[model samples]
Target: MTFVITRPCCNDASCVSVCPVNCIHPTPEEPEFRTAEMLYIDPETCIDCGACVDACPVGAIFPDDELAEEDEPYLRLNADYYLDHEVDAGEPKPVRTPKLPEGEVHVAVVGAGPAAFYATEELVRHPSVHVDMFDRLPTPYGLVRAGVAPDHSATKSVERTFSSTARKKNFQYCLGVTVGEDITHDELTERYHAVVYASGASTDKRLGVDGESLPGSVAATDFVAWYNGHPDHADDAFDFSSARAVIVGNGNVALDVARILLTDPDDLASTDIAEHALDALRSSAVREVVILGRRSIADGAYTNSEFLSMRLVDGVDVVIDADDLELGDELARQVSEGSVDSTIGSKVRLAREYADHGAQGADKRFVFRYLTAPTRILGEDRVTGVRVVRNTFDADAGRIVPTEETSDIATGLVIRSIGYRGVAVDGLPFDDAAGVVPNDAGRVVGDDGVHVPGHYVAGWLKRGASGGIGTNRFCGQETASSLIADIIAGSLPAPTGSRDDVAGLLASRGVEPIDSTGWAAIDKAERDAGRASGRPRRKIVTVDGLRAAAGG
Candidate 1:
């Protein structure tokens, strides 16, 4: 391979559009892209034109001759994706445009993240269907702006597509508008033909042990938001006075947190990380991050591409304990039997290589601990350490079982990155068990399995929190199908009011809706501020700051 795509590929898929050969698998149009940790350039078909090298925003692509020794494995990782599938013979058929309603229609989409944006983009395909988007924050593009790691600038580029969707004629944005607080479900239902909810999962999974709320313990959700400048967590502080930190989950979120912690402060200076987080990192004492996996190496949830990417960051040395990498007979048999796919098997194989060689050490160390579970977080006012019990892989049972052995790791900070869950919407029937709106397909259904007329959902609210950006396309399409079916069947409720009336209602409540033009001012101000600092963009992290910047 003369060229390769490596660890810094943040799934933006920009390179796919640039490549003349279209060798990248799961080009965001394919289903696998949603679940993939990162994109890979298929070694079998790449023409070595090196168009990807210039297109990669994070500098993730490089000719094989210039590949970092730590990232040499990606040459195989990229090739591995095509092992089970045939290479594309030619360009894929252009994506099919969604069939939208034929006449003037008004829809209210509550949220302005990727899911809502995707749904909105589809709704506006019909020139006559106008969409009004409402989000709680003055700024939109929920996670893209405030949840993605600052270093992953490529992924943020997807927002430009959303901006185009927003600018579509007749589309309106009502930022700083809170659902249920300022306007109730009944109010939206009365004014619009259909109401769609795309508010993403907002809460983090809990460790559910003692001292979880200690000053030193935090959620990866807040940590990410704090660094990426989420308004709700802009003032939050993390304890970095200790030399060692413990992250309780081994998923991609944990990987992202680890990368941010170990990346050199100077490297973050030109990124969009909030000033507060950058300042805290500059004065930090943390040198080691221990990511604890509750399952065996074969069961690790993070993608192999992410595992390889972490090694390429300049300051961190990542090590996997030698004993943990051993496939332990059963998993090895599965790999040999072809019961286990190569994408997953690669993690165990390459992890063993890191365990065998990466321990020489560097300025910072990132270590992985498999088959370990934290039984309790030990301490009172602050997290002093965690008490963990050894877990044995019960291959037949397909679960991790507790053993008599125990271990204690002394650490000042513990960050939980288990998962994310959605909160209940006031009027919608929510399945607390799944943290999702009770739905059949895309139509919001009640607990008794009866459809809630005109109510629909997309993205994390429709499904659980999982998958990446591409996943939302599936959801947006499904919800659009359901809503369009209802509209065609004449089953949708007739709107009792007009756009003027809805605007009048907001005026009566003294709520000023920020339109697309106002949002442009905020975007411009943030970029102008970034220009002064020589960064990509400087985020406004307060609701007041956002309002002022938007010329409110």
Candidate 2:
């Protein structure tokens, strides 16, 4: 049997280059690669070299026979992709590492997340290129550490790859240093040949409804950051006293919040979730979480992998009303005929399955309400309920239109998980509508559409908040390529200042940037603490605590 690409697939295409028989589909060269949730292996390709198993950074590949019970579905899912598309199974192409110019090049990257690390990985490949990565947080791996669900350890395993890049001789990290405050953009440009901003979307998109600012109404990003122990939201509090929680969007983030709220505290206790968040979850009275979507199920933003994962949660019932899905006879016919997109077909099938299989009367329940939009959050001081209006998916118009039907969902909390928006950098040109830095293929663009000299962007900051962890690899590489192209063209000039000069300037500013050694200390301390508790590393949720763990 062929190996299966499981849910943790980062879609970085690392396995594609290493596959001996080219079994993995949606290669970087394929158009489907851009939208594919995860790469799949063709079951018909039988050499079974197992090379991808070692090449995958996230440990997503497993032999069909070796697959865990929870992941058994992926075996069939991998083969299903081949049913629709023909498998080429061509010879693997040789991997190529780009050669760099001879002159020494130093680039400063703002943000120590996956994007920055991936970009650094590209640049540091050349012995002549040096990278200095900066982040305001004392820690690195921005969203990987602060946004990913703590229970998704396989996804978090990608930190190992980032750590490898950190160990590169030419790379350096300047943590806990604010760019606009401690050092200006001009200062960074003066100190390096180029500066690449990878600081991702830090803020959430608002619902723009009345009573949204109420105490119990919060953004899903805040909840994610809070549970993941982000220092900025470490002290944030949530009232889980209400039995029902209403989520304004039906995205993966909403599912994550619902699962965490309804999950057995014992299951989460072993994760790296924040101590305070864990304590709050343990005492939570929330038993039912209603996820509202303004559009039909076919237009759902969440991947089928995440939607199906809800079924695996023990002691939790996934409730989906068949009528709410709005799956007309035509859509069902398309799904049955295999004419619809495979991703959408799987999602619709899974949703119908959930709807058909009535709830087993589990203690906790996650309900999906589609074609519903929240008009207002109802409460005097805090969230009491959400006034939502039912919408009809005007398939002919390809838009959702409001109907006369309106109802109130009784709940203590309302979480808007609509989406994330990037914050504008103080010195960079920002696209207010897109919530991204205006850029053309990773090169920063000004208001006049001219490229900003020695300035570049990667990740969500460049393209808006889209794609997943592995998507950043190519995104960062594109920015790095732009920087390289600038370097080759002699457009990027050598720095006037040196690293020592920058260090002295930071010292003068009283900004004690945490070095790699200090971060290692903090990591080790957390792991050691977690080992004592028989859990993964207990996260240091506060900035002061992280700094203290890093030996100040």
Candidate 3:
């Protein structure tokens, strides 16, 4: 019997400590763990201990008997880990908790994203710790509120957890606070025992193609932010009057953009969509969305669950080329037979349904165009079309190779959903290539091989852009452990200034950080304003609006 790790693992390695037989290889303590997407349970070890299943918070581990037909490949993947290594079926390592002193320790976390919230929650577990969290926008939950598709209400529920954490007395919520521009990192470090940089990846990875700078062309990240009422994108405009639109990547984000555009305007209006964006969408003439992928559909970036959700959306036709539906291997054949519940099977079923009933005259259609790479945007002042080249799959090289053969697709707007990259924070060491701060576990690394004591990272900044909400829990645990270790080691700095002193310093510098009460007032005003607007809860989508609503 074998056990396999699925997509939900998030590289957190909680399973590593729980496997009683030590069959789970590449624990986070191991050098290779950072590079592994998920943990693997060696099938040949024959211990069959279910300790890992109990440890995984997200339920990523599965026994051989429980493995769905689609997950059978993971059985082989897990077995392969032991092909060249000595098997270790020894006793599991014990779980360790942080040790802290008796006094309260003040900490400042920059960014109101999931990482920051989780880190603060973990820190507060040490009864003697207090957290002051700051964000540039008045609202919190960086990506949950801004980047996630508004239609994904289930994922949006993460905000509830964050809200609950913010209610803690030791945790302070400071909105409308920008670190470098409003307050310096040096000042934060000076005022708190430790400072954590959880500011998530803010910028989109641009598609460096000609005409990408056109007015109608936009990054999917920015578009998501605009529709989701992110303050930064409040004034941004999206043109959907064109019959057709083109998306450059085939990630879950691309699927999100496509679904939002293709969804019924009436359905969207009832949700928490921004009033302005919803109004624009109601009048949108968009009929077709072409999702361009450099590789075959088999290697698309979106997960099975996301694709399934896209297919389940009402009043939208998911179109795909019939030729592309040909199963190339045994796994694909199994997927086609419905013997598997894998991601590809979900997408294949949707594609087959759409192809059977052609979407030529449908109200809205999302078409998946495989083996196509965007060469350039075609337009003068606004996006009018896209030039695409044929691509050949290089199985050996594990990448899609673009060919010279080209085609043109008419489109009114272009959205690139390539990926996200982290940015350098002031007074922190950042890796330009990896788009991460150099860190060992949670300890921020600096030149001369010295660790920046009391500074830490979690979530995407520490592990890159991957995993879901639950992923942050373990990431936060690791960072918190490191923090407690530092405190126990007497390496953490003592808070030099009082709360009033920090506030006075900020006021002197013309920067005002919103207190918890102010955030509550802003929250109330938004809910009231949303009630008036006849939506679930309309957000004050601008910094000025939030400030005004908060009576700042």
* Model number with the top TM-score: 2
lDDT of 3 by residue, 239-308 (tens): 8889998998978789889988989978887678888898888888888899988777766777655654
Q: What's the C-alpha lDDT at position 156 in model 3?
A: 69
Off by more than 4 A, model 1: 1-34, 38-72, 86-102, 336-339
Of candidates 3 and 2, the better by lDDT = 2
Off by over 4 Å in 3: 1-97, 325-361, 395-398, 495-500, 532-534
TM-score of each: 0.91, 0.97, 0.81
Number of clashing pairs, model 2? 0
Quality of model 1 by C-alpha lDDT = 0.83
What lDDT does model 2 reach?
Answer: 0.88
| Candidates, ranked, lDDT | 2, 1, 3
Could you give candidate 2's per-residue lDDT for residues 1-552 as a string of tens digits? 678999888888888888878889888777777678788998888578889999898899998899899898787678778778776888977857767667788889999988888888888988898888999999999989988887778889899999999999998889999999999998998888899999999889999999999999999999999999998898899999999999888777888888888888899998999899999998999999999999889878887778878988889999988889885557768887988877888788888889999799999899999989999999998989999999985668756799999999999999999988999998899999999999988998999999988899999999888888767887888888888888878888667887568878999988889989999999999999999999889999888998999897
